[model samples]
Target chain A: MGKNKKENRRNFLSMLGTAALGGAILSPVLSKAANTALSSNVTEIKNFEGRIEDFLGGDYTNIKLRMQDDVRRAMKKPAKERKWAMAIDLRKCVGCNACTVACISENALPPGIVYRPVIKDEIGTYPNVSKRNTPKPCMHCENPPCTDVCPVGATFKREDGIVVVDYEACIGCRYCMTACPYEHRMFDFGEHYSDGLPAVAAYDERPSFEYEKEWTRENKHDSPIGNVRKCTFCAHRLEEGLLPECVTTCIGGANYFGDLNDPDSVIAKVVSKLNVSVLKEEFGTEPKVFYIT
Target chain B: MKKIFYILWAVAFILGIIGVGMRLMYGHEPAAYGSRVVWGLWVAMYIYFIGLSAGAFLLSSLVYVFNIKIFEKVGKLALITALVTLICALLSIWFDLGHMWRAYEVITRPNLPSSMMAWMIWLYSAYFILLIFETLYAFRIDSGKYSGEELNRLKKRLKILASIGIPLAIAFHGGVGALFGVVSANPMWHSALTPIFFLVGAVASGSALFTAIFAFFWKNKDSEYFNQMIQILAKIVLVSVLFDLLLEWAELSIALWMGTPAHTAGYRAMLFGDYWYVFWIFHLLLGVIIPVWLLATKGKKPIAIGWASLLVALTFLGVRLNIVIPGLINPRVPGEALAYIHPRLSFHYFPSLMEWLVALFIFALGIGLFFIGNKIFKLTEDTENKAL
Candidate 1:
């Protein structure tokens, strides 16, 4: 009985070894086939020379798809080598604020903390008035004044030029909120939209995937609930080879996002070809966000 | 009168307890300060109490380091007041933190070189340690534990600590000023004069409080030396108040004259905004004019100087509020307040009742600690004269 058991074990081991060798030989070919299937639609968008106007006038889906492709390409480089940027074409924006809603939904943001807000202005007198909408996001400055004032070094600039707050480390002195030139940062006062409700909605209590960490607001004293939060260019989504929620949900195709270091990327082209201006440039913050007015 | 004070203290203490309970339970939900005008009464009170502590410590230094004989009687009392008020200041800012529990992170992992706030924390910690040692030595010498030579040795050590403390006090208080001053984003606070202004204000407010405490609380208030000390402290308060006003004038006049709207907006809001009375009524009328009048006209009378100094010390919070709030009233981006319309996003600010209660609690806690400490340590005892 012992001899028969050993012989059965040897037969099983030899079969497993044959299977491992065969799988190794076939793995590369199978992965290549899978890659082709995944990128079949993406490959059609190669060498796209589309301007902001063309993208707006033509199929808006193409621009989003092109940006998705740009994001996928940028993810190949190391974080330090890539510089993420956003450009808002002011001429194309309508005041729908879908991006704002998308961000709120994406981040599970509580009351009093807004990652983006669309600023509306009415120019000229009553008879000749024209309304303008400007969506404001964190500028993610090259020399971020907000990061410099943090007493605990809780908030800092990531190598990819996105500014993030370490919720665990932030003392939440609000010194950064005061120091921000654009006033982009918001303090989470640990409020809830469902405060007075009979039962808390599941959506209101959902966790946000910020900085690739699951931050569930189960307790008011938890990290993101009391920490200062701002836009991270939808960093977690970017890691999954997807565009920022604001960029994808922009109704008028107004927002552009890609790696600025890549000269051929859509954002790099839009920034260089257009006469773009940054808000509060005189402060010398050198904002990564640009606006094509 | 003492019964009335005790009743008030008890009431404030009870209310303050309720406020702290709400703060722990609700977080910042019950507070009014928000993203726009980020700081409110708590921050103002923090500077106010800290200024008092710094001011009191420096006055104590005059007795310990310089050996100013007329100031000798009130020296130990001044040290205890410093210690108590320093605790109050720490509590005020500690509760103001969003994650009050995580406050130790500032010590554990600090970003010193780039952040003015980090420098302020380090300096305050150092100053706090130096103060404890100095107070301990001063009290130990008077504890009747040591004889002639040992007492002299303790006195020498106290003097050495006091001397180290003078620079430490100046740096920490000035560092507080620079914490606000270095924010180039707020043109109002961004100035070379801010640190100097803080030091002067500290001396003014601190000396005024010392004078008041001496006038009202001294055991032998009827003594001739009491009158002499009060007179000298009144003079110090008067000169420092004028000096502080002079700095304020320079800061205001320069900004108002030939300055662009960006630079002048904060001063405009301060001098003539919704809460203009903070500057005009509370600060100018009560804090400056009335106090100055009493000190100048009734310089010789201890009772009159006490009232004047009390007025100055209490209303100096108006000055602190003016410094913190107006710099934040104007939007960094024009029309940003209208852009996002939440109660928390707006620029308008008034201290919520919870905030006031929390502030009251801190003040009561400080007073309570002072009474307890005084009882145990015989803080105001005439040990020095007995030794002499």
Candidate 2:
């Protein structure tokens, strides 16, 4: 339990400078990433958890984790509705590019790379067909090819059906990029945000999954660069009680995010009822992103 | 003539040095062949030099190991040439490693399945040691004419050790071929037969080395003995290239028949994909089949043999490129476009001025030092006392 608390403290520390998260977030995060966080010894757990609890003083602090009731509600939603999924309704998309802009601002990504883009394709050969714009983001595959060839397990498939990269464990070989047929992976190669590259280059300095913005700012050295990158399904927001920025700003609701496992979930209903499919199913990557045919 | 020759040599040296230096300092752009093409030009060069070095070393061994007097005339030159090319081969790999500083860690923290990585460290060290011993032994055997019992015993012992070195030399280089062949990830190269292919190519290239350099040296010598050496070398070249082609055809034939997705795609790529032109025209016609025919039929004609030798040398360079580049271009899975482009000199690569200067300085610097080293040791093969 203490091991989890330490991670929560670390996660909590990354959140210090952000505006207050209001209420309803603390109990469960402490239960999840921190419960098994301690070294095995009972004495060790007592000392460490006591040290952290003392550091936090009394309870009633606001963290950016999900409220317990929210998680339970999400779980209770029928299998079709509760599990997460994303739909890019190409028909409804106007190509306004707001989703692309929102993903960039939210990720605080470096220049020369972007998490999403509207790729324009033309169908007709000789004045017959029309032009269509499609947005490209990470597929967050069920059998994510990037996770398959990661030699050191740095890029992994999480319990929530998302593939995430543990940047610290990354060896910087960039073998994952070659494995990905989608060409989603990018190498950082010492990139930075303009002249202030080194000054604010640390991941801890950016918005992270933590309790307060100030603590996160002070402890921003935890996430490193000179590694591979990709869209993370906005996992940090998934932890907070908000929908991903792209999904919220998608004006057309051309994009949807909900549990695929839950039958009553919006994602499940659309996938089962609508004639939807995924890109490159022939490659057997089992991409999580659903597209209405 | 000496001044003109030095100028030409200097120009080549400068180009290589500048190419090397540019890669080190500028830290290479992503599109400069992309990280996927890491084994491109430099790796091709490395294998090329290694083949040359092994060829020269093995040729020199024939005289010492078998006590062949007819081949003794160029023994010292052969040994030194081997050493130079070995160093050149190492420089190719050094330039290739992206984490060049951590190169030593590959040895210290070894991943044993990475056969190329392991063999690289081992054979380089072994080849260096063998060259030193062989050079000193060559000098000592020559001294036996002046001295008495001590020198003759030393010559006998050195010959015995050199005989053992013959097989080790073969293994050292053949193991290098195994490095690429064993990688299942690369369908174009993966095969149990690759090591044998490498061995035969080494011999073919090695024989051609004798023919080319021998012709250069023969210009200043009496023609009788020179012609004799050329005859023997031509035979070696003819047989080796023929055998190598047979083996390659077998591998390709098997790959064609397998019809598995990866194997068939790789075969199609070599025979008909983008790589088809280079494979059919540049490497096969120029590198193997045509030169084998030329060497077999016209070897005694010095001009023919000379042209054939140079063609063979250039062809082997093409072969090295094909081996590394084609394998990388194999699509990772079925129906996907290959991620890597075949490495070329002109793409995003201009051997930066420094890269040219530094690689030139390295090669020329090594060659110049080697020349001085021979002069210091007086490494002549005139050991009449150790009679043929």
Candidate 3:
């Protein structure tokens, strides 16, 4: 309690400083304004302007240096602090793929491609059948089977416990797809976010030749294609200091996000209080996502 | 007469190049194969080629190791074909990867638990070195300059290396089969017979494809050596197919008759299900019944025999397609939609034009290289001119 109070005071102080500076200097990449408070206390905002100029090479005279400042501040927090994790309350989940939808909209995933899904099982049969839904994500496992068997290291668990893919490095062998037991992974197959896509909602909805899906669409290949993708735990959003879209938007309130390493974190507390169990526990994958049955 | 054939080869080569460029410009997703059907043409083609190589090597080993003089003429061609098919097989796997560049990391990382990782590194490397030495020994024996002592020394060494390949051939093809077999999630491919199935296909496809090449080249040329080799090859292909058929019946019968849920789910999806036509019509009839009948018939006309050989080669493709596709399309877990039950499934897919083109390029390259090997190593008995 005392440690949290101290940390809270420190966070409040920096939150004020960041607001005063209009968050221009700090990237706000840290989760929930907490880690940045502890680590970024030194180097006053005025001095940070120097760092920002060096980053921009003094050429941002017309534009607000705040943009670079935000990126820089984000860069300061360690990779661990940059990523936010989600914990699903399996008990709260009603087997509806609401989190799947939230993930689709948030990441602009291609059609038939989902970032996360609820695995439904009807254990037992006929008269006494009981249906249970196990919501699954990447698992972000420490000893990930997909990573172990990738042959290319395309899917690698980042230093901060978040598993990430260097899509460019991936060869589309989908070997990782086979290795994953939970079936949390999926291949892109050059598919796009089609069928029920909200194309109008996109900010910079250009043909992304880099990803190949958009290129296939622009060139109009019947295959909704390019590379391979699955749930990334909303990596881009985490880089910008936001709850994963699935966590924020889940109507069931089945999702919670916080640092698992931190004992007082909501996610940490949930696991501690609920005696969480990871799916395929015997697999020894050390999956970061904990489910409360 | 050979000059005219070269012109046709040049045209095919140009078209193959265009196909590769087209694949790069677009991508592989648009091909008429779904994610479940991911390893359709190219993967099957790869196994076909690998089978040919392994089969040819084993046949060549009979002459080298077992002192069989009757098959001497084909011994060298068999080794070279092995090299060509192996190269084609590697290309198929390379193109299938999600990130094409990091393929070498498989070699560097070396995860021992994964058999694919180990086979991916060892089999190709071992095959390459063996091929080089085998080619050298063949030419050394043919040169007529080497003394009896030197010939014996080289032959002894080649025999030792050749012995290693017999095991490698079984392990390599069996390992590839094991890759699919070990995936117990899909009961269709989960039996102990899966690897045995792959081995049988390797022998049948490998022997048949070799016969196809032999007949195509020997049709115009009067090479008694090649003709005799084809007769021997015909016997091999016919017998291998029977073993392959027996295994298929065993695998299917147990799955269908026993009536376990997993077996029933997989059998229904494959046998009397959506892929029923492919299973019964393509694999059972074309891959098995008809081709075996053609090879077994005693009608003995040369043109008729050549047709049978071509059919065997064509049927191998069907067998490979059936092996890879059936397991993938059927969801391992029943009661869920295709997406939900399938692990690591997202999109329903068929390979695009790009995928087909890249696969074509690989296939053409294999055939082209085989032709070149035939030219260089006296794969045919042409004395006037050689690839050198």
Candidate 4:
């Protein structure tokens, strides 16, 4: 029995040595073959057609790249023909708040004004606990209650379905703020994040490009200082053919944006295919922002 | 007593000037109302003063339109009170605006059809013009400046203006109620009864103010007619107070009965929240109970009725505060308040000192204007006796 075991061990070692040598000899050829196959796969991806859902089904990654292409494609259409929308996948969101910080930095938002806030709720008892993180942005509703309540037609919905406030026209009565069911609108109380400091930081006083206008906080009595502000879906960025700050900065790739008017767009496909819902559907606002639960 | 009152008014006026200076220099920096609780003490004061004006105007219509003989002596006084209080209301709202200079936009580029606010502005503009003309006509006829058909023509014109004013008062005040009611976002304010509730509140508080002023400051206190008028005004105030209480009960009880979190959250915050005493102590105890008891038991005594009406008039601000604040304290999205951390982003709200100072200034200014106008116009002159 001892002799047989020794012979088996020797045979196994010799086989292992032969296999290692053979693998080394064939490594370059195998690598070249793999590279060729990968190139062909890239070509296939580049030439990919059909629904976004189908594309994502094959490869769940590269969603941002796909949505970017969707944006570029939508930009070719006229402003009136394009409808901007956002879809957030709750499953993908880890609640890192990268999007929230990104939005503040992009807009130069003051202390009191927040365009997007991720609401984190912990449900159930300790053993069965689960968490939900919902990022609340302006719904940009089809039937916005805010626009209807502005005493001076200061706020209105654009043809492309973005609700914007004419900061100059806003008398700062904040009626629109109260009128919003989502409470998305915020009144700029002329506050600064660096208030009470010896000198306000340059970043705190930096101008935000909203509605394609440079709004500076140099004067407290200026337009945006007292005006009502909300998420315009980063309208200025859209005008420049770019995605919203939140969409681009979401580390989880949870946020998707595109033209809802285009049936081929990623957002449209996601909305139609997924079990999507809106915040406060009972209000009948018909929100453009959809949440994939 | 008059000396002490003057001293208090002087102090308030001085402090008010300082508050105005701070408001100008710092903008909204000193105000406590943040982005979440957007409207605060100023808004409450605005509605309070405006309700007083609307109520006073409507009551005066009883004299001018219905030609009620007993209230005739107080008609001009009521008009002057309405005008002064209207000015105070406008000032309160004007200070609350983000752009006080751009307020004219509501008139120039108004969204009239969809906006209840625009309708309010337009209606009030008409009411203001009508009020001015009505006051001028009533005073001119009382002055005996013209004789015969001209006098009759003036009286007829005054009657027409007052008649027009009745509907105008109702619409404007009811519009104010609709302003809050139409906000479907706030389950507390969104009610079909809000407009009616506002009208009732306006009448109750306004007549209470008129009662207190007449009881305390009538020119001829010893006149037998003065006692009768005081007793009658006390009865009007007592009924209106009870009615206002009924509406309050309906609003609170209905909301609390269902106990639906969405509908009852605001009421819960109002009745059992940190400032619960505002409803219980300030409004129910002082504004309603004490005033009701005094007006009911001592209805014939001018001094007692005066104190009761004064309590109702002053403490009614507690009612306004209850209405405006609780509607905003409960956020639509749960955990929204916790999601954002900033002083101004907070849901918790209490009016800052600056806000109270500004309000005090407005009140003092209104009183000063009333006295000045009374001196100039002899607002309480027994014009009927002199004319007869």
Candidate 5:
């Protein structure tokens, strides 16, 4: 009885070995089939790179090239000497929300936290109505109200005129939010879009490069999750000699970014226009962002 | 009545534990205050309790600083209440912070020149230290362990502390108002009168709380001094309420009458918006008129005085809510609220259930602390009491 049992066990082991070899041989074939199916869709979108023109199908304006040139010129000077500025032409803004989406993608903003939005206003009656779109980003004011109200000295205005918040130092009092006239600040509530789902997806756990630092939301109770957030003018991208994501993604070619200290820059000429204005001018925030009608 | 009080306390304590647990686990995920209406019930409760602390401390000053003979008996009680309420106030604001763990950064790296909040933190720290020493001295003298020259020396020390505390209370409480007043971004809170108004409101609410505690909790309430004390406190609260009302009217009439959109928008929202009852009913009617009438018609009666004081103290939260919310609801740029659409991105706000539960927990904790202190210290004026 023991000899028969040993012989049956050896036969089962041999069968298992044969099945493992067959499965290994078939796995590559199955993967090849899957790869072919996915490659067709991948080829169609391979060149898109998340640009607005990829979806809108418009001629390339080369605005990104000019902005990149401006960024390169600004990088040569001392950080304090080169003042970063942005200009938005309301006439050219189609309000396609490309800049808003681009900013979210660049910053990897969590749910309910937005750094930029295109405010739409309807003018006149229904029959004669015309809609006006204004894309709003952080004003990066020379005298930012948000910076002055931070109790912990977490948020401060740099000599280069950018308002930056030190996530490590911020106590998340939200006092800065109350003090901001623009209402541009947003608090992170540590929410996940993947909540209540069967499983959390990889995208939900992805890390972002903000302030040129790789930050992963490994836990709910962490910095930037409890901290207030606003636009940093793609400062991380700027450090790498790349234009802001919004400036490149603007489908209407409305947004311009450059060094305000450089007279030859496109943003400098755009900001000099007589029609240029700013939101809540009475606040004396002296916003670095200019809007042209 | 005693059984009912115990039952309520137990319920509140349990619910408070759950609320605190949720806060620890979630971290403001349950709160309704968004970026638009950034300051909500917690902020209101913070100012409300801080105002009570300032008010109670100042009323005690009448006995210690000004040598008012009438308030002498409840001097220790008033100080203890102020200390307890200040703790409650600090906890409320502490929980409201997003990074509560990093709250120490305010003391370590204060931006004094540009931030009124930083100034408030530093001033309150000084006030807190002063309060501890003053409370200790009150107990030390009442111990009756030292007689003659030593007692006189203790009294003199207490007087010096109280004298210093008068300005400290004013500076910190007025600094709280200045914290809001300096925000020129919100026209509703930007007036120069904001700090003065906050000081008066604090006094009114604080004195009312003191009067109620004396009438309801004093073991020897049948004493002749109790009746006179109640009447005096009732009169003081009445005058304070009237002055606060005058300030409210001045602010409302100036903004409403001007009809300028920039200034009037927030005022209009307060008086006529969806939460209009918060101002008209809770604050104006219940907080002001009912108490004023009760205090005026039956000022001599202890029960009437107690009820009026209690009503005023409880409903003053509505007054605080009005001050915080209206200032934040109006957007600086027109149509700013429409720029984004999210649950928390709007200009409208009311506290969530979690907020109320957490507030209730703080209230229960404060009551427990006060009761424990009373048991240990015997805060009554009776000479035969055990020494602290």
Candidate 6:
């Protein structure tokens, strides 16, 4: 056993040396390859389909184009027939918060309202420490506790499995906020970045077209202000044949969004894998969002 | 002393008017409650006042339904107290709403199956109407205008109304408890014990308030009848306090006995956090211990019993604050508190000055309503000489 351990240590050290030498030799050639690929931009779907083998063989695959394809494919089906889902790859996330920023801008979120937040966890003690970034958004659960607690019928799950809040009907009692285990919902306290300033800017006045309705934040007591706000999976954008802002803005290409009902769709393809885990599955919320470690 | 009380009420009323104006004009912008701690002092006060209302209403039923003659004189006062406190409770919750005007939607287009709040609203409405009619029948029986047969019929009507009110009060207040209890996310409140605790708390605090009023306001203070009433009420309040304490112990010890971090985080915060004094000093000491001591040591003394009951009634707000705040102080996600820094996203919370001012206004409004009710209607047995 002692001899085997010594031999194993030597083999590991040699493997490390070989890997380092290979990395040094390949770095320049990989850069040159990337440069050439960037220069020869073949950005058409039909041409891309014809050159699918070449694209597959290439080191860099454009995820945005792939996501656009996924969105288009899912849009062809009826809303009820398409079950929307999100799958997040934990390994790829750098916690740059681009997805969070994109969600805020898309939703016109106020200072207190955050529809998506990346939670950072530092695991293990100093010498063995490694960090994990988990971006949380509204899970749009099948058995949503938030919907059942709404005093008014202001929030409900749709046929296509997205939980939505009707700002006009919501009493702003915020019972739903307490009911949500994930704490994904936030109350818009009718505050703006330009609040308490001498003159509020026009950007603050711009209407956010949530649920395909024009919600202009004209005053404090208006709908969406003093109401529970949450991520809608960018439903308005989805209806307009666009991917959710978070999916498109993720720099690491960690987030996948598509019809879970379509087995051929990107999200549907990865979600059923053994590695995928849903947050608080023991609570039986049946969350549509899955995380892969 | 009476002049000083009036002066305090006047000052509170004026400041309260300003607070109401601020609330109406600015909405929840002036409050400290954020998205993280969604409920605040107003929610606490709302439950506090509602508990008092339900307690008082139930006590009145004890006389009319159970025919507890010792509490007969205060029965009418209890009903009136219920009405006044119910109004205060409604107003307290109304101001807490993000959109106060849209509150009517709760009744007009309520989602019955999904929400306990919808049921609470409907039940409160039914209870409100029943209370008004029951109090009126109570007044009619006391008016002495009817003959022997008519008076008996009026008494029968009052008993029937009280019988209906017993279940209605239980359902309405239990619905309030279920409103918080059904929240599976909040481990502190999600228990089979929540509704039972609320019911017991309502009785303890309600009877305490009724006892104080009897001790201070009853005309024949030196009469044997008065002492008998105070003794009985003191006993009721004492038993209730003990029972409520038992429920509280079960809630605390069960969560804390094993010391599971997830289950005990809220309780630990309540017992050891920055506002630990709220649970230990305010709720346990002033609300429970001191009152329990006074009731025990000086059970027969009207003055001591009155002071004990008064302290219990006033300090029960601390118990309410503990309930509303602790359940929400702990973040759901580990690093969610630090994920984004915003006042609304904050885990730590205390009511803003504006919130207190509004609460003062609500209490002053209740007093004013009670005084007006007393003057307009023969709400008390002694006030039979007044024109109805």
lDDT of 5 by residue, B1-388 (tens): 9899989998998898888888888898899999889989999999999999999999989888898777777889999999999999999999899988998988999998789999999999999999999999988887878778788888899899999999999999999999999998888899899999999999999999988888788877788877777778889989998899999898788878957798888888889997899899988888999999999998888898889889889999998998899888887777678887887788889888889889999999999999889888777544442211
By DockQ, the best candidate is 6
Per-residue alpha-carbon lDDT of candidate 4 for residues B1-388, written as tens digits (9 for 90 to 100): 8899999999999999889888877788899998889999999998999899999999999889998888888888999889988999999999999998899998899998999999999998899899999888878888877899888888888888999999999999999999999999989999988898999999999999999989877888888888899989999999999999999899888888967899999889988998999999999999999999998988778999999999999998988889899999998889888888888888899988889888889999999999998888876655562221
Error of 5 at B165 (Å): 0.3
Q: How many residue pairs clash in each candidate?
A: 0, 60, 34, 0, 0, 0
Candidates 1 and 3 compared: the better one by lDDT is 1
* Tens digits of per-residue lDDT for model 3, B1-388: 8898677667666776776666555455444554444456666666767766777777778777786776666677777777778888777776665545556766665455654645645666677677778778777777767666776787777778777878877887787787667654456766899888888877877777667666676533456655566677778778887887888788878878968775666566667655577677876787667776777784244454556767766667667766666556554333334324332252233455565666667767777887777766666663421111
lDDT score for residue B134 of model 1: 84
Fnat of every candidate, listed in order: 0.86, 0.00, 0.29, 0.83, 0.81, 0.84
TM-score of each predicted structure versus truth: 0.91, 0.62, 0.72, 0.91, 0.90, 0.90
Window of ten residues with lowest summed lDDT in model 1 chain B: B379-388
Q: Which of 2 and 5 is ahead in TM-score?
A: 5
lDDT of 2 by residue, A8-118 (tens): 544543332121242226534543334344333223324222232233223444211212223345655443344456777775565667887788678765444455666
Evaluated on chain A only, model 4 obtains a TM-score of 0.80
* Candidate 4 wrongly placed segments (more than 4 Å): A1-61, B385-388
Task: List, residue by residue over B117-232, the lDDT tens digit for candidate 6.
Answer: 99999999999999999988887776678757777788888888899999999999999888888888988888888988898999998889878877876777777777787898
What shift in Å separates residue B161 of candidate 4 from its native position after superposition?
0.6
Q: What is the lDDT of residue B85 in candidate 6?
A: 94
Comparing only chain B with the true structure, the TM-scores of all models are: 0.97, 0.85, 0.86, 0.98, 0.97, 0.96
- Tens-digit lDDT track for model 1 on A1-293? 66755454454334433543657577445434433443443343222222355533333458789888889999999999899999998866766788988999998888887898989998877544556788999999999999999999999999999999998899889999989989999999987788899988788888999989999988878888778999999999999999999999985578899999988788988888877899989999999999987
User: How would you encode candidate 3's per-residue C-alpha lDDT over A90-141 as one tens digit per residue?
Assistant: 6456566778777766665554466576768777765444566777777888
TM-score, structure 4 vs. true: 0.91
Alpha-carbon runs more than 4 Å astray in model 3:
A1-87, A90-98, A101-112, A118-135, A140-144, A153-169, A189-228, A232-243, A257-293, B1-15, B32-38, B113-115, B219-230, B299-305, B332-350, B382-388
- The docking category that best describes candidate 4 is medium
